[model samples]
Structure formats: structure tokens, C-alpha cells
Target: MNFSEIKLVVIDIDGTLLDNDRRLHPETMRVIEEVQKQGITVTLASGRTFISTARIARQLKIKAPIIAHGGAYIARVTDDEPLYEAPMDMNEARELVALLEASGYYVKVYIRDELYVQVVTEETLEFCSQHGIYYRVVGSGNLSELDKNPLKIVVIDTPQGINHVYKLLEPWKTKFNICRDTDRGVEIVKRNVNKGTAMEKVCAMLKVEKNQVMAFGNEGNDLDLIKNAGLGVAMGNAYAELKKYAAIVTRSNEDLGVAYVLEKYLLKNLN
Candidate 1:
């Protein structure tokens, strides 16, 4: 890939940028700043909600529009308004939320900037805390009364738990898209919405060509984003499915994979 021709670099937040422990390496931070100084646009793209993604964007001092809610919501870090959004059909969301609740899966729904939960588990609390997402308890009865459609619904649980819930939703596969956000969590969005579509929108807004973008990710949710980018990188710890689509595989996030690539591939070509 021609690094000099790239103008945008999209980084996934959880498994790709932060280590399993949820810590951002100093070397990673330093390299990000260095790349920005050289005139590349760096943005955070993830399955997180806007409120959650914005906190990390603030910490990184990124002014770019962030891709959140598994690419269903894209918003500027500085404002509440979205650059783009594709919410699930209200009836579909209500039906899926009900099914997940019936199956005893912990479900969180993103409605605009707010998050609503059917039940708060320890897993829910930890996820909210990790992403700085604030949520309120809204049982099934109250969910239907909400005025807006949900950006997406996330089921948080152990791998087996999520898998069990995933199986129960098999009938809806033709209607909604379901994918794993993490080993323990599953995200559901409208069929046509995903990171790649969102990336296409972002590229259009930025007036950059698809061949001028670079992306880093490590899971199924990141597949399309990786495929559409000019140069796609997979973290060393990436899922096997994702690694197949990446042009390069870097060190694990814990090992500063992001930093290593920036220095060797990105920054080296800036001069």
C-alpha cells in the first residue's frame, strides 16, 4: 500500500486499540499524535454508543466524527447532532428486545444518545463503566412507549450465554443483522447498516477516496471496514475470520500493535 496516499486511518476501540485489560498504551498514544501532526485524520470506530465513544475521543484529543453503535451512528465528538445515523425499524427493535428479554439475555439499546437496559447485570455495569456509557432501566413495558427507534441492541453475556441467545434469534436472521461485538457480547442492527457503509459515508464527507483510507480492527464486526479500506490491518490477537481480510497483521494491542504499524508503515512514509 502507498502510505503517502492515505489520508484517513480508522481505529477500532476495544480489542483493536485498547488491550484486554482496557488500557491504552503510552506508545500507542504517542504514535497517534505523531501521525496527526503529519496531517492524517485519525478516528475511532466501534460498536459503542456516541456517549461512550466520545469519552475516548476526548481523551485522545480527536476532533473527527466517530463511528459508533456498530456503524449505525456517526457523530462529531464536539456536538450532539449526528453526521449520519441508521436506526433499526421500531417494530423490529421492539420485537427483538422482547425476544432477548424473554430468553433472559441482558440487553442494552441505544436510542439516540441515551442507553436503555432491560436489566443491569455486573457485565452491563462493567461495559457501561468501560465506555463511559450511562444507562437507565427500562423494562419491556416501557420500551414500546419510547418515541425513537433504537440505533442497535446489544446482548451482553458470557460466550455460551450470547451464543444461546444468538440461536434463539435465528428466525429473525432474514430481517436484522446480528454479530458479535466481543466474545461476550452480541450487537444487532438493521441489515444494511455496518462499519463499511459508515466508512463510505465518512469518506464521502471527508472527500477522500476509498483507496486513501486505512483501517485497524480485530473481529467480525470489523470485517467490512477492513475490506473497504485502502490498507486494512488486523491486530495480532484478531479473530481468524478477520485476519484473512487484513493486508497486514500487527502485534497485539497489549504489545502496541497500533504504534508499531504507525512507526513502520505510516510515519516512515510521511517524510
Candidate 2:
């Protein structure tokens, strides 16, 4: 594909854009600004909350709409009401929480932008420490205690824990979107809420064609986004399952992979 046809750049946060320490590379930041000046829109799509994703966009100083909560939410870079949202059915969310707790896995419930847990466990702390997320302790048994429905739910444990939860939720897949977000984490959202679905809406709102989008991602949750984009870039650190679907594989996150490709292609356009 000719990279010059690209009009929108959709990026994932945790593994696609951020470094190992969860920070942006200066060169990456510079390249993004340059892309925007070239009339290309750079947007973020992540399993993270709208608040957290917005925080990253702010640091990048962008004002574009973002897909957050694994595509359960789409809004401008603010706390404003979403352009679109698909909250999980309350009963199903509670049931999944119960099943995960019964199986001895830690569950995180995301309502709008707030993260809640019965209590912070070692797994929760370790996961948050890696990404610098702040959460609240609900001090309850499960999501049954909350009257509000969540936009997304996350289960954290070993990679084996991912398979266990997948089997446990297999019957519920008809009602929710389930995918492994990391080696030790599985992300859940309402059915049809993955980034590919969200990207459709984003493309419409931005008035861009599917053949003009260039996306970058790293995890299993990113599968659909990678599959459907015009140019899907998988990081070298991405899983084999995801890499096979990429148009091309780039350097790893630690090596500023996203910026490397953009600078090469977008710069070529300049000269």
C-alpha cells in the first residue's frame, strides 16, 4: 500500500505507542505533530478509560476524539458526554464479576472513567504500577454492589488465567466482547464494541474512507483493528497471532517503532 494515501492514524496506547516505562518518545511526539500539520488526524484507541486516554492525548496536545474503554466509549478529548457509548448490561456484568470471583481472579469494573475493585490486590497493584493507573476500592464482594453499569471489565491474573476466563465466559460472548488485552489481562466490553467497530464511527465523523486509515497496535484485543485498517502495523513486540494480520511489522515499542514508520513515510511525502 502507498503510505501517502493514509489520512487517519489510529493508535493503541499501552504497547503500541508507549515505551516500556509507559511514556512517549520525544521523536514520536514530534512526528505526530508533523503528521497533523500534513492534514492527517492522529487518534488513540485503547482498552483504557476515556479519562486515562484523554490524559495521554492531552500530553500529546491533541484535541481529536478518542476510542476508550475498549471501544465502549468514544468522545472528544474531555470529560464531556460521549459521541457514542455502549455500556454493558448490568446483570451480565454482575454475573461475570461473580463468576470471576468464584474462580479466584481479580476483576476491575470501569463505570464511565472510574475504576473500581473489591480491594486492590497484588495483581492489581502490579498491573497499575506498570501503567500508573489509579483505582478506587469499593470494599464490596462484586459488581452486584454497584447500581451503575460499567463500560468495560478487566480480569487480571497469569496468562493461563486468560484461558480460564475465556472458557468461563465463552457462553457470555454473545452478549459481550471478550479478548486478551495482555499476557495477564483480559478486557471485556459490550458486544460489537471493539476498536474496529469504533473506527467505523470515527471514520464517518472524520469523513475518511477505510482505505485511508493507518492503525498501530500490539495485543489480541487489537486484532480486529489491525485486520480492518487500510495499513495495519504490528509492533515487533506484538504477538504472533496479531503479526500475521499486519500489513507490515515495525520495530518494537522500546525502539520508537510508531515514529520510525511515520517519519519514514510521512517525511518521504514532504520531499
Candidate 3:
């Protein structure tokens, strides 16, 4: 495939572009900038909130709108109004929240940009702090009132706890899209709202075809996007299942996986 023919590059943040330290590799950022210089659009799609993803978009100076909350929301970096959103049903979200809390896990709900939590655990606090996400402690507060419409719910716990919750949520999987976004947490979104669907919407807005796009990811939540992209590049650190679905498996994130693929495949002509 001709790299120049690719019009858009959609990247996942956590395990694709960012290393374990949650920071973008300098070489990767440089390659991304180089691609944009060639008139290709580069955007982010993540299981994170728009507010958080937008910050990175701004730092990268990419104009393409970001897909956040695991594709439940898509918005421009400068605006709060979402171009597209699939919020969870309030009643259903409440039921799931109850089940999560009952499982002794801290739950974080996304109502647009704000994150609402009834109680902040060490892991939750660390996550928020590391990502620069502002969270509200709505202790003993009505979740419905705080955010009647939620885009996604993040259940924070140990790996074992998340595994247990995953099993309990298996039945509701038909109703809600549930996947482990990290080793210690699971992200729950409305059914059928995911990276692939969001990528389609983004392509529509850009007048780009699916065959003209490239995507990279490293987790279960990213499976849809990986399968749908014209070129799906999985990181060396990606889950085995995710790797199987990718068109190509690159180096690990810490080894500058994003940059490696860009230079070797997408940016070869430029080099």
C-alpha cells in the first residue's frame, strides 16, 4: 500500500502511543508531526474522556477531532459540544454502578467532560492525578442528579477484582459494552458504541474512506478499531487476542512502536 494514500491516522493513547509512564515518546511525536505536515490527519481515540484526550491533541497541534470515552464521544479539541455521543441509559447505568460498588470497586462515571465518583480509592486518585483529570467526589449524592446521562463508567480495582466483575458483567454484556481498558480497570459504555463506530463517523466527517485510514491499538477495547482500519498495527505489548486481529504487529510502546511503524510503513516515502 502507498503510505501517501493514507489520509487519516487514528491512534490509541494508553498502550499504543504512550509508554508505561503514560507519556508520548519524543520520536513518535516527531513522526506524527511529520505525517501531518504531509497533509494527513492524525487524531486520538481512547477509552479516556474528551477533556483528557483533547489536551494531548492540543499538545500535538492536530486539528482532527478526538474520539474519547472509548468512542462514546467525539469532539473538537477547542470545544465542549460533542459532535457525536452515545450516552448510557440512566437506569441501566445506575444498576451497573450498584453492581460495581457491591463488588468493592471504585466507580468513575463520565458525564461529558467531568468525572463523578462516590469514593476515591488510591488507584482512582493515582489514575486521575496521572492523567490530569478533575474528578468530583459526590459522596452519598444522587448519581442521577450528578449526571443523568453517562458516556462511560470506569470500574477501578485490582486485577483479580476486575476479573471477578468481568464475569458478573458477562450477562449484561448484551446490554452494555464492557471491556478491560487496563490491567486494573474495566470500561463500560453503551452497547455498540466503540472505537470502530466512532472511526466510521470521523471518516464520514472527513470525507475519508475506511480504506484510507490507519489505526493502532493494544487492548481489548481497541479490537473493533483494529479490525476496521485499512491498516491495523498492534503494539508488541498488545494482548494476544488483539495481536491476532491486527494487520501488523510492531514493537512495544516503550520501544517507540508507533514511530517504528510510521517510519517503516507509513512514512517510508518521506524518509
TM-score of each: 0.94, 0.94, 0.94
Instruction: Encode model 3's per-residue lDDT on 60-100: one tens digit a residue.
Output: 89798899999999999887588998999888888888776
Give the poorly placed runs of model 1, Cα more than 4 Å off: 140-147
For candidate 1, lDDT tens digit of each residue in 46-142? 9888888888888778988889988999989888689898888888788777767677666778887678876667876887777776788876546
The collision pairs in model 1 are none
Tens digit per residue, CA lDDT, model 2, 40-147: 899999998887788888877777789998888899986478999999889888888888877777789888867788887887687566545777887757555678
Residue 142, candidate 3: C-alpha displacement in angstroms: 5.6
Model 2 TM-score, all chains together? 0.94
Q: What is the lDDT for 188 in model 1?
A: 88
* Native-to-model Cα distance after best TM-score fit, residue 165 in candidate 3, in Å: 0.7
Mark the regions of model 3 whose C-alpha exceeds 4 Å error after superposition: 140-147
RMSD of candidates 1 onward, in order: 1.7, 1.7, 1.7
